[model samples]
Target: MSQPGVLLDRDGTIIVDSGYVGSVDRVEFIDGSIEAIAALNRAGIPVAVVTNQAGVARGYYGIADVEQVHKHMIAEMARHGAHVDLWLFCPYHPDGIVQAFARRSADRKPGPGMALAAAEALDLDLAKSWVVGDSPSDVGLARAVGAKPLHVGPAGSAVDNVDTFADLAAAVRFILGDGELAMVTRDERPVKFPAARFHRADSYGGAYVNELARAFATVDLEQVSRAAKILNDAHDRDAAIFACGNGGSASIANHLQCDHLKGVRNGTGVTARVLSLSTNVELFSAIANDLGYEHVFSYQLQSQARPGDVLITISSSGRSPNIVRAIDWAVANGMHTISLTGFAGGAARRRAHVCLHVDSTNYGIVEDAHQACMHLLAQYVRQSRMTPDAVASQTF
Candidate 1:
């Protein structure tokens, strides 16, 4: 019989995420990580380190550098009497800068290529195995291979409905079935975002522009792609896409209605249907005055939204009561939920099916990024229906 094994994520799980760690000198193992591996080794369970090395594809480092670091890792573990049966890393990304490594590969995290290879090489049973990591992609990799998933991150990081641990040691204990190490439940509270990034700049223009560029770099293109697909699906089915937000986010939500409706319909084959819950002042004021302020969006959703419609909520803090309520309502009613969140994505981020998160603490930066996202999605969906020649010739 093939034996059960464990698949472990490298950075942020077994070691600290020092950002594209390419050299052995920067390898900093997490506390208790060595002991945790030793415990697994003692139990006669095979372990494999499966990681995504996007740095290699991004031209930050080469495959040789990655291999050297892996070798260093293996040596470090050996000195401590722990053994990792296999080491696997995926070095491909669709938007990578290195031509040799740039392109999509099934070996990437959330893809089953590496897991399948490890299972075969190690004579293991994936159905009985555990995949532990600190990111959503790690959980996704587990699901893709039918393995048990354990998250190792903060109290409320966005990958929902999975077993979470404070660190790798705790996750290891759970995998070993230690009775004292009970699984930790997610707090589901709003996480605190970092301090302001542009406050200390020498000049306003330079600081603001640089901060915006940095924040934009952290935006997940994959999440945006998923959200675009959802919007397109709704458009194809002739379902209304509802948008809501408050203050600056409200403006973005209102703008979304314009771009998604008129902007996407001009040359597109489909007629887009969109509504902004934040735009109707008379009805919104009545709902806030009568029912409650938090009921503004949900109340509208209940009356107009259908099962297959889409809800897009924009919130800088992501914890606005009304926004959270609307997302919950839409999800419960079978409508697709997408959220644009910044400053430690809160309940709305967690509840939404797709979260386009802006990793900025400043409200202006977040709102600016959200506006760009709205425009990108509208244009993408618009051009998706047009011929390449027409798209090239037409003004956006």
Candidate 2:
């Protein structure tokens, strides 16, 4: 096998983390970055850039802009006698506002997908490779691929329990065995929630509830507040709110329409116009049978949705093709989009304008959280418009 290569993270590691850097003019190589790459090149180690460009998904820039920046990076590195063998960037973010660029991708950092790709492309043995970066996600990528992780950043920025270096140059010296620094033996790595936790529990029900509480804490309260405001604004303008989901999530979608429409309308003077795209079983089946399942929600949106409307998608995994397509269509057609997601907040979460994500990997916990989110939004919107006396007198 060939000597192990190095996978580098772009922002903060190779270059300064200029927020959402798109143009070449904004690309600033961190001190010693060029020299570091040159050192790798001199040692005949292949180098590849594996970075996430969520700015594209956020509608701050386009893919071409990212490529342009990379080109500039290559030229700058070349001037310093460094050469990058490959440049790989992930342009998908689940929370992007742009219709075309928004979605989830396997190549995103921390997933090991991009690392596997770089291994294949560079013919490098991942187990012997080094992943150098400045964030926990970078270390996570290394761990996922069974590579040695080298964290480079300011002294205080070191991730706990990981080997840390002052900069890329320092990390490079360590890799080449020319440094006085000592490499720490790792005793810990990122771990997944064990299914055994349920089986070995003294009380399975109590264990489940405890997990649920932890998941609930992960829900961004700020996002929930933002969603409430979106619903409020939609009601104020009389714009329609449409929701869709699959399987367990489908039930939440239908329930959302009912509560937001009838439940929110009774006490609150605000008349909410809501529809569940997943409610029409015949139409959904027809769309699925004819146009493919991915088009089910989006197909319905095309018929009745208009600009300034709202779309709310509920999916536990949030990677459902149909949910992603619906968010894509909604954003493209100038509609406000929201998604309730669980388990890593999949493409639907990134694609939506607002995301209320449940952080649990358990299906039951996530679905229950999503259902609670639906009810909370409906009730909040209702109470916001009602007088204190009216709120006191009315049943939610």
Candidate 2 residues lying further than 4 Å off, grouped into runs, are 1-194, 197-202
Residue runs of model 1 more than 4 Å from their true location after superposition:
1-23, 26-202
- Backbone clash pairs for candidate 1 read none
Ten residues in sequence with the least summed lDDT for candidate 2: 183-192
lDDT string for model 1 (66-96, tens) is 9999999888765554568899999999999
Model 2 per-residue lDDT at 70: 90
User: Mind giving the per-residue lDDT tens digits that candidate 2 earns over 31-82?
Assistant: 7787677556544567999999899989888888999999898887654446
TM-score, candidate 2, is 0.52
| C-alpha RMSD of each candidate structure in angstroms | 18.5, 19.4
Instruction: Give all TM-scores, in the order shown.
Output: 0.53, 0.52
Total clashes for model 2: 4
